[model samples]
Target: MDTSRLLRTTGTVLAAAGLLLSGCTTSGSAQRASASAGGATGSGAAHAAPAVPEEPSAALRPYYAQKLRWRECGVPGFECATMKAPLDYAHPSSGQDVELAVARKKATGPGKRLGSLVVNPGGPGGSGIGYLQAYAGIGYPAQVRARYDMVSIDPRGVARSSPVECLTGPRMDAYTQVDQTPDDAAEQAKLVEAFKEFAAGCQERSRRVLPHVSTVEAARDLDLLRGVLGDEKLTYVGASYGTLLGATYADLFPGRAGRLVLDGAMDPTRSAIDLNRDQTAGFETAFRSFARDCAKQAECPLGRGNTDQVAQRLRDFFRTLDAKPVPTGEPARPLGEALATTGVIAALYDESAWPQLREAITQAMDGDGAGLLSLADSYYEREPDGSYANLMYANAAVNCLDQPPAFTGPAAVTAAVPSFEKASPVFGAGFAWASLNCAYWPAKATGTAHRLEAKGAPPIVVVGTTRDPATPYKWAQGLAGQLDSGVLLTYDGDGHTAYGRGSDCIDTAINRYLLEGTTPAAGKKC
Candidate 1:
């Protein structure tokens, strides 16, 4: 899941349901995806850096000056609009432009309008508009919502923004079951073959949209949104991968940057392999937290054993499933090691899902894997009707483009196994192999590891959770140190992002920043 690009919106605790994935995946609502904004870091200048433009170039100015024609969407109070951006920023007049999907809930003023606050629930692929409609508009602090129009944009190659499509439901289903932690050459070949097929599918289906879906391009789209919405500068809150997008936005548009919050941030300085290892360790840390809590429960599935024992038991269970996949109630869609791993990994995003993970693992160990299978389905954004959302396709598209492959081939993965396992003994092997997914990508790497300062940008707030599983806490420290005006707000807690999750201290501080343009002190911890 490199899930350093954490599934923020998918795991978001929704108002009508426990998690958005519970409702967002229905065929009835395609734009309903990013309500779960997810992570931090002072980030980068990849590729020696393009000279920062002091002003929008003449070609780009047209994109910046364009206006949006808002119309009512299916969701009440939310207005939908489509905005245009060049398909390639380097060549704006290429005659190819991307139409982005946007949605906003106008400010419900109690005093005066403060303008728009754009949010992204960090999928790189997740639906920002969906997030705005499902939660941000209603769940954000009342005062904040009252003064600012809650806004979201479906970045190009994401849901409702000409989403990147790949394999059909059935092919994707087969792809998910292929062995990731291969024990033999044959199995390893099959794993690589699956990745090849997935990449090939994306290339075949989304040739035009695939190359332009990088994070840099998405950040450019955010600036475009800022212009059309009439905002003088970008005011944003980005979660998980969204944090990277926001950081990149600030880096690209320093002068145009306003109040920005990057929660559960990614360190742009990290290479793809480093990110995979860091996230692998992060999940292990989170799993230990879940393990400690689970072991104290009377219904604990792994018994009252220590974390190592429990982790061993889980790994053993995965091995058993590898040889004999269990029926998931749906005869055609049985549960295998890959699916079970994804199921468990999905639950690691938020602690609230720990109970569900406990029950699912219990059911899987008892030979009925339907519960675990369902969790895996949710992680992949597979709908009830066997169709899948564009989440994974866009995830891969953006990820592969954002950095070079984690491994070049099976030999490379084999060599890296020891280091990855050292990082996370419980899930390292799988994470290591999963990193191989991008190795076979069709696109050449368009970006590289670099540090971002966003020099001259206004004070930008960076939030980090100490025990965040998908994005580690140290990333926050790194991101804060990198930004010239970065302010660090630490949540000494667990789960993904800090704000709107639970802690009042975290919420109050962020609210002050968003509402009054107040920056938290240099080192504020919740």
Candidate 2:
């Protein structure tokens, strides 16, 4: 997902680990019924693939040998560090370098330490250090926290790590509500201009960093971090987009993978177009689940009706908002269809937020859109003061650099709309158009879709929440099947990620693996 156009993840609080199909309009039928909350079981057939060379080149030896300078920062008990990595690995000899912000909470051990266990809560744009300090530092199971040092690094071009900057607060505000679901040529033209301006602003403000934030570079940075931490191998727990980062690292440094757990996994072999469509379908699946549950309630916003009826009603509401946006308390902003849709999608990540969504929708239906607007604001990381974080900027920078655009222009999107709508009727058109955001990206993509068969790696667990909205369960299944040593752990449940959010079955398996290096049984369902 293009984090820039698609608002994903809250900054410090790792509340929900799900994907939001942003910058798209709401218009999709149920792609699939709600998936079972059970682990996947099938043939463990590995695809024919070459092994990734584990060793780093001699020219880059200095970077791998560099030591981190750590100092106490943020919450007590967590120490922060900084390291410098080559801005471009292809030109390691170049003088250019990018700073990485890292944080660790040393193991509170009574037993032998299990080395550093790095954690990332997706959003290629999410602040790893922020996640470490706010959640993992204190919220991880006590046993896991006591045995292993919890570590994180804000990848290049993310928060506090030489971030990518695009539009200012006011400009970004206007950009979010651009007629994403264009009804005519003029609206489409305006949408294209918005993408162009966003791309141009990123290039203008963050020219140097934009091109270097690809997942490949970020994964390489992880290997460097592993070396500096004095860990011969990398131990990691990554969710959502973080799974892509973890898989890339495992592919790049197979021998270095030490009990990596990729929750909410993405299929490395899939193209950007397929990924967006699959994700669109996932959201539709999730929304249907939400709609079905909503219909059972007396205060249901879409009213007590079947899934299709509820979905159609919501679509109708979106069209109504598109025609005449509801007044949000904020003077400059109105509850337009795009933002309102984002607000609703944000809640679909975790079932815990369903009640909030119900309330927000009820409020929106009642002529007050403040609740829904607040939800949208949270999705965008827009502060009450109106300032925006570097999340969106960095999201685009990394996503665009990681792969070629899914669609090159409005024409291509128009051509692909039918397939997208087929995958997700309500969300298809908007997401099909949203896929074009990267078409106008300033930097060329440095990576391509490929299978990660980390042939020499230790057991690497790939977790999937069957009903995951951002990364569908099938992605996890696909990734596990592709990796040479991947094991599947399924959490047949509601929400984006399975670990830590609440699942003793899932948590126990992960904890045992992280602490004792015990691989969960293949096809383990929680």
Candidate 3:
């Protein structure tokens, strides 16, 4: 089916088995704030601007001064804690609070303790705690993990952090199958209704949480984590959309910024439509790379034709599925175009999934749709029992709040089709339509496109993969150029993220920064 939209735009990678245990909570206690380190740029070069205030404003100081009570989580060597932040930063005394879920693995201590190193795998909705326990804690360099406590905070309205809920399993199933590429007025109306219903469900079930889950608010939450942990400044490693969160934190607290590594960076200056269009083109670039690899395989699903001919063949397959779905072994769940497209797009996140995609597509072409349906299920985080995780729900909530809708309605999307199609001939129309999901959001947009200079912040490393399907590499270059103290670290590779991916150059550059606070030289490429 015609799934061209990259799902990484929504969900983070799933936690490995046995890492979803609930964190135990305790009352917070007071702690003295650590003394700030003055202008310790990795390169020892002076910043273009002066450092910001070491202390927050009187209103925000309380949040920065609060402490957390850590208790043992089920996971070995990990402690879980709950930190409180204002539901509305504008009115901290409103007596309203959002409880954030946090987890940490203390440094093993072969080297001098470097303090906490917070990590986030981006989703706008991904479980930071899950990522910490499953991946970063165990997968990060032993040297880095031995010195700095690996930490994570599930952003507000994500995972255990007051997660936003939307449509029920059955309703969501129907919603996923709704035709994104509307061919007629009736179909377009149906698509609009599905979006409206989804938005309405979020508002109905999560009204109190929906309005405050923006990236700016989440960044504010990160500051609270920093203060409670008794850290002098924020030392962070953020991947994908997590980079956006880290950049926002840098923008808000430049002086308190420590060593920051933003892998798979997003340019904060783009409008919502531009982000979608650029991402659409990114997926096309990634697809061509995948297509070229597939063409050399013994059992290429798209045939041995040139890249353009193969893309057209895949497009034709999606069109065929749009008109007629095939049974995917699940009696009630036939494999339709929308689901198939999502299935295909999900595999584009990392090259390792390429063989799986080829096999899934080959199976689908042979009238067996189960394999592709499974891929789509994985993309949506749909459980075997038909329930769905809050990934998509929180993704839409945070995304809708962070910026205005890319399109006001189907008409706007229709008007933009030519440009989007020009960006990506095979998958452009579906993604352009998908961008309309936020148009019917219940809350008014709370943010806008702006440059994140993070002026005077300590040197921040921005890593970009050359063929990343979600955040394009150019966005990294643009973000690095925008930040006054940004350092560019280009990973001349594929995949959504760069670090800890078997690259000695990338890992060494990042590890040095995280451990020794040494930033890579500008324009360093792996």
List TM-score per model, in order: 0.93, 0.92, 0.91
What would the per-residue lDDT of candidate 2 be over residues 86-173, giving only the tens digit for each residue?
A: 8877667778899899999999988999899898878767778877887778888999899899999998998889999999999999
Off by over 4 Å in 3: 1-53, 57-62
Cα lDDT, all candidates: 0.79, 0.77, 0.78
**Candidate 1 C-alpha error for residue 132, in Å:** 1.1
Model 2, stretches more than 4 Å misplaced? Answer: 1-55
Lowest summed lDDT across 10 adjacent residues in model 2 is found at: 27-36
Q: Which candidate, 1 or 2, has the higher TM-score?
A: 1
State how far residue 136 of model 1 sits from its true place (Å): 1.2
lDDT by residue (tens digit), candidate 3, 139-241: 8899999999999999899989999999999999999899998998999999999999999999999999888787767877888889889998999998878
Stronger candidate by TM-score (2 vs 3)? 2
**Model 1: runs farther than 4 Å from truth?**
1-51
Worst 10 residues of 1 by lDDT: 23-32
lDDT of 1 at 402: 75
Candidate with the larger lDDT of 1 and 2: 1
Clashing pairs in 2: 25-430, 27-425, 27-426, 27-427, 28-425, 28-426, 28-427, 37-492, 38-492
Ranking of candidates on lDDT, top first: 1, 3, 2
lDDT of 3 at 494: 67
Candidate 1 Cα RMSD (Å): 6.1
lDDT of 1 by residue, 84-169 (tens): 88887767777899889999999998969988999998876788887888778888889999999999998899889988999999
Q: Count the backbone clashes (under 3 Å) in each candidate.
A: 19, 9, 3
